[model samples]
Structure formats: C-alpha cells, structure tokens
Target chain A: EKWASTAPRIASTRLALHHFDTSYSLRLGALWPSVRAGLLCEQKYGALLNNFAAADHVPQELEPLNAADFVSEASQKAQQWQRGAAVGAVARGCQEGSGEGRTVMQAEMMAQAEMMAQAEMSPPLGASISSKIKCYTFPRGDITRFRPARPDSLGLLDYYLMDAASLLPVLALNVQPGDFVLDLCAAPGGKTLALLQTGFCGHLAANDISISRTKRLYQILHSYVPREVRDTVSVTSYDGRDWDQVKGGTFHKGAGAGSVLLQVLVDVPCTTDRHSATEEDNNIFHKRRTKERQMLPMLQLQLLMAGILAAKPGAEVVYSTCSLSPLQNECVVERALDIAEAQFNISIHVEDLSHFRTLFQETFSFFSDCRLGELVLPHLTANFGPMYFCKLRRM
Target chain B: RALLPARALPAGPGPCPRRGCGEAAALRAAGFSQEQARRLLALQPRLGPEQREAAAAQLLLLGLSAEAALALLERSPALLRLPTERLRERAEELRRLGLDGGRLERAVRRSPQLLHVPRKRLRAAVRLLRERCLFTAEQLREVLGTCPAVLQEEPRTLHHQFQYAYFRMGVQQKEMVKARLFQTPFAELRNRHIFLERRGLYETPHKGQTQISNPKLKDILQLPEEDFLASLAYSTPEEYEVFKKLLAREEEEKEEEDVDALYT
Candidate 1:
C-alpha cells in the first residue's frame, strides 16, 4: 500500500514539472540570451518563475524605449524655444537699425545725386578728380565739395584731421557769396574748407601762428577747394592777435576786391578736454587743468579782443571753444561785453536745438539757461568733445 | 664744574625742512628761543595766529614722538603747523567763498595781503549776511518809500535824478506816459523846456505868416476818425467802410515787406 501511494505522488510531481518546463520553453524562445538564462533557472523550481522572468525583461526593454521618448520630447521642446528666441532677437535688431540706417542711406544717396548734378552742369575741365570739383549736399540742404591739391598725400592727412562740428556751424551761419571771412585762429583748415564749400566768399583768409600748421592748412585748402575758390582763399602764417599790425594794409587792399567783410570766426585755444581720450594718461587731466586754470581764459580774452578789432562794424563775430569750462564759455562772453562797453554794443542770441536734447545736454551744463549760444557737450550727445559757441553782431 | 653751552655741542648739519629756516636761525642767534624760530617759520608760510597756535601744538606732539610722527609730517607739512580741525574749518570757509584753501595759502605765502583783515572781514560779512539777499517786497517798498517826496520836489530836479538813477541801473522803460520827454532829441532838455513846448502848442504865433509843419498823408490818415475824419472826410457810410478795408490791406503788405528782408 505504501509503494503504491509513493508511485502516484512521484508521477503527479513529474507531470507538474513538465507543464512548467513547457511554459518556460515558449517564453524563453522569444527572449534574448540573458533573459533565456534567467528563465531556464526559473524552470527548475517548477513554479511560475519563468513567467515572472519573461515579464521582468518586458519592463527592462520598455524602460529604454521610455528613455528614448523622453530624449526626443526634450530635444523638440528646446528647438521650438530657440526658434521663438531667434525671432524675437531678429525683430529687435531690425527695429533698432532701420530708422537711423534709413536716414544715413538717404543722406548718402542725396549727396551722391547732388555731386552728379554738379558734374553735369559744369564744363568738363579735365579727367582728373581734382579738376572738376564736386558738390556734396547734406540732409540740411548745405552743399560742400572736396578740392584736391598737388602733393595730395599732405592734403589727405589734413582732411582727416578736420573736425566737422568745429567748422559746419560757422559755415551754416556765415557763408554768403562775396562775403569776406576771416578765420582768425584757422589751423589745419577745417573751417576754411567749409567756407570754401559755400562758394559764396569773395575772399577767405585763413591764418595761423604756426608755419607748419599753416602749410597743412594750405595743402588741405588746395586739395579740397575748387581752383576758382582756391584762388579766392589766401592762407597766411601770422599771429592772429597781431594781425592788425602785420596784415592791416593787405586786408585794406583786399577790402576793395568786392570783399564785404561780414563774418569772422574766433576759434581760440581752449582746454582740450574733448581730445582727452586720445591723450596719454598722466598728461591728459593735468594738461586740461593747466589750460582751464591759467592759460585759456587769458588767451581767449586776447583773441576775442583781436577779433573785435579785426571785425568790421556790424559784422557777425562767432566765438567758439572746444572746452566745457564756464571760464571759457559765458565768462568769456561776459568779459567781451565788458571790454566792448557801451561803445560797441553787441547782442548775443542762442540758436535752438530742442530736437537734439541729448546733444544739447551733454555739451552744456543743464543749469545754464544761457540760450545766448549753443554748447555742444559731447557727454550728452553722440561721440564728440565739448564745444561752446556764441555769435555776436557788433552794433 | 664747567657749564656746557647747548650751542657748543655739535648738532646735525642737515638742512632744515622749514622754509626760511636760515633766516629764522639768524634771528634766533641774535637772541630768540625755538618757539620764536617756529613762529618765524609760520610767518614765512603766512599762517594766521590761530593756525600758528594749532601748528605749534601739532609740532609739539610730533617732536615728543619724533620717530613715529616724522613720516606723516613729511607727507603733509601743513599738518605739523596747524590742527586738523582748524585747517578743515579754514578749508570749508575758503570753499564757501569760491576759493581753494591750498591755492589761497600758497598765494598768501607769496604775498601777505591775501589775509588782510579788511578783505577777509568784508568777504566774511558778505558771505554771512548779504550774499544771497534777494530784495523782498518790503525792502523794495523801503527803497521806494520817498517817492512822494521825490514827486513833490522841483519837477526838473526830480526828473533829472530819476533819469540818472534809471540810466545807472541799466533800466529801460518799455512803456511810459510821456514818451516824448524820454526821446533822445528831447533827452537833454529840462522839464521846464518840455512844459514850455507843450504850452506853446496851444498859443498863437504873433507873425504876419505863421509857418506850420505839414503832416504826412499816412500820418493824417492814421489819426482817429472821430478826431479828424468823422465830420469832414466821409459823407456816406459805404465810403468809410471801403477806406477801412483798404487801410487793413496796406498794413498787411507793409508787414510782409518787413519779413522778406535779411536782418543784416
């Protein structure tokens, strides 16, 4: 009876084991080697271990798929974000560049057109660029031209040295055809260039104390001014202050040459605070301070007195400085008034620049309500040095 | 026992840092103490009495601890001669007066009148009281208090004084009732002459033929209609209206002519 019971139990156990092995074999056939080994071990237990192992491998394979999906999603989101940012950046850049760029382009185009028109109107003097002087127009309707000189290299250097702000305002205010203009402290010839550009002057007398500076001025005038205007302009090397003693007779003789002595520009020596960026570190502040403290005010007053003597009665005298100091600005004006006394009454009126507030504020102290002249403070405006100007009409 | 003289002992031959030390030493040799020599140095530097006293105290402190104090004294010699507080106060006062103390001190050393009492007194007084005193309404009223007395005086004298004062103050009368009196031609004439001239306009001339200056047509036309034209010139209302419109057009054209001409 005991043997019979044991035999039945063993047969049942063997059948159950066979059933587990069949399930595992099917499961492991679809799996990789790693999964197959794990499933094979599970078959020995004669339980559902093979089924569990196959299920575990399913999750393992799905994990990498989930990771891949996550990576793809992240990359797509980043690309979309970058595209939006790029659009915003491009729109901002276009908005900023458009207005200023358009104005500059238009001005350049107008200048070129004016030059072409002048060339067509005038007779062809020669094939040389210098032979036919060209007119270049500004946005404000002011026209100028470059006159080329012999030994053109020197002329080019002088042209590069010219500062437009120092010359343009005086040109705009004073240039009249057949008018005699005296640029008292004319050196490097920037103002002379503008004066010649107007084609209005009967004579433009450019004077400087230094011979070398006068040579440079002459070279520049010859290079940029047309031959007709170049003949009219005379460059002289003489102390402007002592011009009364030196050139008094010559000036009187020139007066009869249809020269209506109407305008004089007194661009006196001043503290070079505007050119401080170009100066060496140790010398910059000290140099300006010395000029501001001692030398400039005296030189300015003397030059202004000389200008008054040289100026024809009822002539418009423009006093200018590339300095921000009050001593050089209104104080000098006040001193001139004092020196003039009631004998030669002169009135000062300021030009308006309300459209250029940033420019106005930078070149002048905001506290100054002196509309008597324009102060072009470079700090407030575009990149420029501080400049002060006053125009007076001698009574 | 022999008494040794301090001068007989050898002293350092290094040059004195104080300005005018040789002069001070010569004065001292004639009979002066170290304090007197120091005072002389202060005088050379043009230090004020207050500055000199403060400087003495600073010098005493430095000399008592010479080794540690020399470096700082060398950097700022002014520190050895003046107390920091007094110097700071002086500097502040100079700044308020729109002057730099260092520059002023240097100037004073060169020329002693820089600290003359009268100049300093006036400057200080102006700074303390009158510098920013913009006249109030009450003050202006005080200035104008004797207007009635002025008006009651001889009209000529009163007018002369008024003209003198006005010219002195650089005042120009934009509007005035008696404009002819202020006119340049009539300016030199007295009020009596002006009164006589006004009275003479009503009086008749005692001559066979009285000459009268003829007025321009434009001036005669500009006269008020009631004064010269209402009774004599116009018989009809239409004529008057037509004349008024013509006058307006003439005035407009005159203004336009004025506009086109350059100021120069």
Candidate 2:
C-alpha cells in the first residue's frame, strides 16, 4: 500500500536487476530485529514486515471462532490463513518440530519454506474449469416406439414426431413442471411437441411468424395432444422479433400470471447448410434465396434479443438453430448479449449445459470452442444435427 | 550460467580514490576488477560494511561466476541494498518448487528478476502451476528453468495458455514445457495455429476421438517458419501470410473467442 504508485516501476526494475536491493526505494532501508524483540515490541508490525521488500499482500485476519478452534469443515482455509498470518509462524510451528532453538531470521526462513510446501497442495487454477456440457447419446427408434397409455375418454389423431436432435434445445430450455412457456418459432411445431412430451409445461403460447406456418403448427398440436392437454396452449401468428409487443413481456398463464418469469424458446431460422448442399428443391443455397440466406443471422439475433426482453429476471430463454455456420450460431447469440446489455439494460448469463451433454453423450457430436452454447455436429451414423442451442438466463 | 551477462566495466574509473572504500575492496576480493567494482557500486551504491560480503557470497554460492554475478548486479544494482536474509528466504521459496541448485542457477541466470519475486507471488505462481496448469512438480521445474518469467504473469493469462495447450492443442504438460509454450506470445501462437487449422492440417482435440496424426506441439512452436511450413503445416509462406491477415481481421470483427465462455 505504501508504494502503490511506484510499485509497478519498482517491479519492472526488479526484473531487470539481479541481486538488486530495494531498501531505499521501498522507503524503509532499516535493520530487522530478532523475533523476541520484534514481536514483543510496540513496533512489532514494522520489525516483522521489513524483512521482505516485496511483501505487499498479507493474509486476511482469522475469524474469531477459527482462531479459537479450527473446525474440520473450515480447517483447510484456517490453516492457510494461519501460515500466512502467523507473524510468528517460526515461533509456534518451528518450536514444535525442532527442539533446538534458532534465531528469529532462521525461524522466518524455515517458515517461508514450510509455507511454500503447503501451497503446492492448493487447488490449481483451471482444474475447477470443466466442460460446459456433459454427454454421449444416439437413440435409434423404428415404428415400435412406445407411447404413454391414453385414457379411454380422449382420442388424438396421431402422434407428432421429429428427430431426437431437434428436441435438444427444448431440453436445454429446462422447462420445469407447471412453468408458463413460450415457443417463439413454433412452426411445424416439432420442438413444441418435445416440450409437451416432457409433461413439465403448464401453459405454453406456441407462436410462429406466418399464418400459414401457424396453421401447420395447429394441425401438429391437434394431431398429437388430446383436447384436455391442448386447452393449455394458445397458438399465435406474430413476428418473433416483436413478440414482446403482443405479450407485453408477460405470459398470462390462465389466471395466475402475476409477475412470474416465463420460460421462452426461440428456434430461430438458420441456413440448413448440410441439407441445402444435398437437396435441390427449395434449398437455401439456391440463387433465389441469396439475400435471405445472408440475412438469416441478423433475423436470428433480433428474435433472440426479443426473447431476452420478453422474459422477467430469472426466466431462461433457449435459442436453437439448424446451422453449422459459426456466424449464424455463436455470432448471433453474442450479438443478442451485446444488444440486450446495451439497449435494454438487461443482462443474460449463458448457462453450462454439461448436464445435458452428459445425458445425450453418445447421440450428438458436441462441438467444442462454442462460447455461449453447445452445437451438435453431424456424424454420419449419428446424423442428427447441425443443431445449435444456447440457454440464456435474464438477469 | 546466468542468462543475462553482467555488463563489462572499464579497468579503472573512480570519481574519488577512496570513500566508503570497504565495499569496493569487497568486490575486488570477490574477483571483480577495480573498475567493475566502481561500476557495480554505480548501479546500486547501498552495499554496506556488513552486507557487502554476504551479498557477493550469495551469488557465488548460487553457482554464478563472478563475471555473470557482476553482470547481474550491474544490471540491477538494487541487489546491493537487499538484506542478506531476504535473498536466502526467496531462494528457499524457489528451491521448494524443485528449482534445485543447478536449476535455480539456470532460472536466475535467465531471469535475474526471479530473485526479486515477492514470497507471496512465488507461492501463488507455484500453486497455480501445479493446481491450475496441472504441471507436475518435475514439469514445473523444467518450465521455471526455461521460462522463469512465467511466475511474473497473471494467473488468468497463465491459465489461458494452459487451456489452449491442453484442450485446444491436445498437448500434455510434458510436451507443453518441452515446446517452451510459455516463451511465445499467445497472439503469435494463435496465428500459427489458426493458419494450420484453416488449412486442414490440424484438428482441434475433442473427447472420444483419436487425433494422433496432428503435428507435435514442439514441432509447431519450436520449428522455424520454413521448416514448420515444409514439414508439419505443409503450406507455403504466402498462404500462411494471407491466412494470418485474414485471421487478424476475423478476430477484430467479432468478440474475442479467447474470452472464457464459462460463467463464474
């Protein structure tokens, strides 16, 4: 603290100088007294500290209880504080180890050595850093997939179906039981079915931008969900970018919608790069859609930002896309973060999906180096995706 | 064996004949020329009657030749004013981390500044290397012996380097130290790596896959550009040059990919 202004300059100089001393520049070019005098004297702090010119950080003071007794739970922390703060580390620890008495300077040297050996045992820096998602999954199912036994009164036309990879974003959304939910781009409604299948969704407002797409979504929801379960859903046709203008940032769950946070999902449109490469009919890579292809990431970013603004604090919004482009996936999520934090003053945290990754480990080829979310890469046998999903918690 | 040489001094140059002459005599007795003692004092003139021999003796005992020791002292005169006990204490701190006498000599010689490290920082650095970087004590000794200045870096930067090597490059600690990964700036390393990656010459290591064909970390970092291109990276300098420019532009146009995605 004393040399705070000149500390940087002194440190640089120290690097250039070997055996260079700092008694003068440090402002305390004085002799240190033996431990007995230094610790017992009124100026013990000065005597104790002056020996090391570079001792800028001192150990934090101990808690009263830790000082009195080190509980097993807090002992590790207490021990560290003791070694650094002991001022007389040599006085107590050294006395017990070696019977022969030594000079205070000897005591200090031994104490430093002992402290360092102990330091080697402390947790390493990145050791605590783990993968954002845990994984391994690929389930193969043919016509014989089992369904829950239905009650006699209600009958649905058919079961709605989709690829297992398409449902990852729904899993990433972490929709809890009885939570109000919104599926922003619910067209063709595959992910919405996955959301409903979990049996955790209470009331969901499944939406799509075009009336035509919403018509298809209604058909899918009707074919799969019985009337009793379908009553909880309200299918709407509104541009995903301006969803908050319609919902007014609050999802009214039947009657009790008071300030509860809503779980939101936006499977934004993206370049189906792999499919576009293989298919000739209505491919995004076709010359007619060049402008639309280029504009996809921007539209996705807008939809995601709206999702963030439409939710209350603690509400989670998942953004997924069928795209391999880093530009479309990671880049879009990053822009939403910047735009939300800048314009709306809303902040978002990208949650770790290690748990989801582990649950589906064998099925998806998880892409590494994705900062905001997880990407399911396409494997020939496990050809489920180019699906990218990122979960953001509004804060 | 100190890496930084003690600056050579003129044979005889003193403003005055004999004033506080004991320190000058002590250096002369320790094998420095009379002019060397004068210049060494010019660097740090604080060595006193009691401190002069002990300070000179400390360097000699660390296996430093009088010439190398004098060069270091000339480079950093502050060593003269440092208390004898502090030097012993700092040396012991490094020694405990596996920088035995020979390794310690090499590390100090390479980075004379290592001698000035605060005991707090040294402890933190060692702990971080072992715990965060996952370097075993033996690998740490090797790292210190080569790039002792790493101890002076912030923990975040050090951890980033380790992660890039471990997860991104799929390199083990032994290879990382042997490649002297810490010696190169991360930007330069990233440029080279991305160039190779984009050219389809390198694959990022991921779990549950065999990536045994990628070039060794040592060959990637230690080889000359021509050799690196000719053998491991398998690309022309022109292509590598173009890629580096594109990489820089790509990096600038977006958020930094290096920033930790993991929320704290």
| Native A-B interface contacts kept, per candidate | 0.00, 0.00
Q: For candidate 2, lDDT tens digit of each residue in B1-264?
A: 543334443334354457648777877888878766666666544445567667877888777777778887777767767887898888878887778877787788778888898988887877899998888878888888888888777778888888988888777888899999998889888877766653335666667354436777888898998998777765556545545554565676455544544433
Per-model TM-score of chain B: 0.20, 0.82
lDDT of 1 at A244: 75
Task: Indicate which candidate wins on TM-score.
Answer: 2
What lDDT tens digits, residue by residue, belong to model 2 across residues A60-146? 222221211111212334344345544444455656566445566566667565444433333221121112111112132101222
Candidate 1 lDDT over residue span A1-395, tens digit each: 76664333323322322332344235323221212111111110000101101223322433343211111222233343344344544554665557657767556545444333333332221121121111111111111222321223223222222333453245324555577888888887666665565556677788888898888887666555546667887788887878778876678567763437657888887755433323343322342344454766877887877777676666777888875566777788778877776555644333333212222222222223444566543211122334567777666
TM-score for each model: 0.34, 0.39
Predicted candidate 1: what Cα RMSD to the true structure? 45.7
Interface RMSD of each: 58.1, 30.7
